[model samples]
Target: MSNHRQAKDPRLQKISSQLAAHGLILRGGFVFGDGEAALEPSEARPAKSVLLVGQAGAAPWPYFLGWREQQPRDLQNPLDTWSREVIDMVAAHFSAWTVYPSDKPYQPFQQWAMRAEGLKPSPLGILMHPEYGLWHAYRGALLFADEIPIPDIHDPIHLCDQCVGKPCLKSCPVDAYSGDGFAYQSCLAHVRGTDGEPCRAGGCLDRNACPYGTGYRYPADVQAFHMASYAGL
Candidate 1:
């Protein structure tokens, strides 16, 4: 599509509205570089731009839960399945290509998120948003054949740097999080033990200890769902 036609297209606005109804937001997008490996497996042509879509906080929990109740009870990775279904529907409406973080080829979602939103990782490895803290996530993205207008991003203050005492690093019982990096085995073991009940039922203690974006923190049930998923329960 021509730039002129893209400028006149109302798809972006419509897409935002439709996604919002399902508790998803267009996190922002970027023009793809030539020869980037972000095309449909069957197609030789690469999409020109990609719009990141995801949820910011517990906004999607209710919608996702409602959707999940209707699906087969034995389904694995229910959340990922629901996300793909929702995002795929929206992508189809606008004739855009759909990609997920869970796709076999493993799209570079983390790098794309940093580039698209000017975000940086906190000590805990979750990208710290100035406003959302650790409560948001990128579910999928929509790719378009033509370059479209994306919002101009300005670098925001990294919240982790400004935190007074860094309560997050100190909150974990096993000290799984630190300046050095995460101790995955330690965290997993702790979460599986009887003493890990608090973390297992309420989500990561380190993540919840963050002061920023408290209002957006996921609810206990939502947190439990994620913790169960993380624990392979």
Candidate 2:
């Protein structure tokens, strides 16, 4: 798994700190394969390494909210828009290319995340973080023409394995998730229905029921925003 350069690079630290100032974290990165691995923009140089960027908990909420206020009225996909603008700025500063999860041709961000962070999926299908639990996300990434020193990934214990009761599977009123798998349509219906107010307002009861990382759980408004998006409200 440890394949990249072992040299200490200051650029990684600088890039990480810069992104953190904007409520983003360097989730992890990897050296690219010969000529191709990910979908690169046409204008991009021969990318040698890719650095995944993302948010943990509610870290980016306040910053995003502040930025959203100054944006034009009726802005669409405001969060993704903000993430792009912010990450793009970092990319430019560091002489890198920016790619997003929602980009055309759809970049393999989930796979990249797994490679970078060594995280596995939860029952909810979201990659469960060791500390942030389900409250983290991959926003976008920066691509560099030269491979940088990627830090080693220390695979942490999967939190779900330690939970005996598995409250996340039980808290859903509709039993949207079961041994058969997630009932997406059923979950959607409940979230948009009259009885879904609790879930709509405070987020997925099942997701909230997870015992790990309570301190990192997103705020109610943030969860509501995501739920609204999920239900297409």
* Model 2 Cα lDDT, one tens digit per residue, 149-228: 78777898999888899999999999998889999999999999999999999999999999888899999999999999
- The digit string of per-residue lDDT tens for model 1 on 24-140 reads 998978887656665764556578888999989999988998998999999999999999999999988987878899887888999999988999998888999998999999999
User: Candidate 1: what lDDT?
Assistant: 0.88
Off by over 4 Å in 2: 34-38
TM-scores for every candidate against the unseen true structure: 0.93, 0.93
Candidate 1 structure, TM-score to reference: 0.93
Instruction: Point out the worst 10-residue segment of candidate 2 by lDDT.
Output: 32-41
Give the TM-score (vs. native) of candidate 2: 0.93
Assess each prediction's global lDDT (C-alpha) against the native.
Answer: 0.88, 0.88
lDDT of 1 at 68: 88
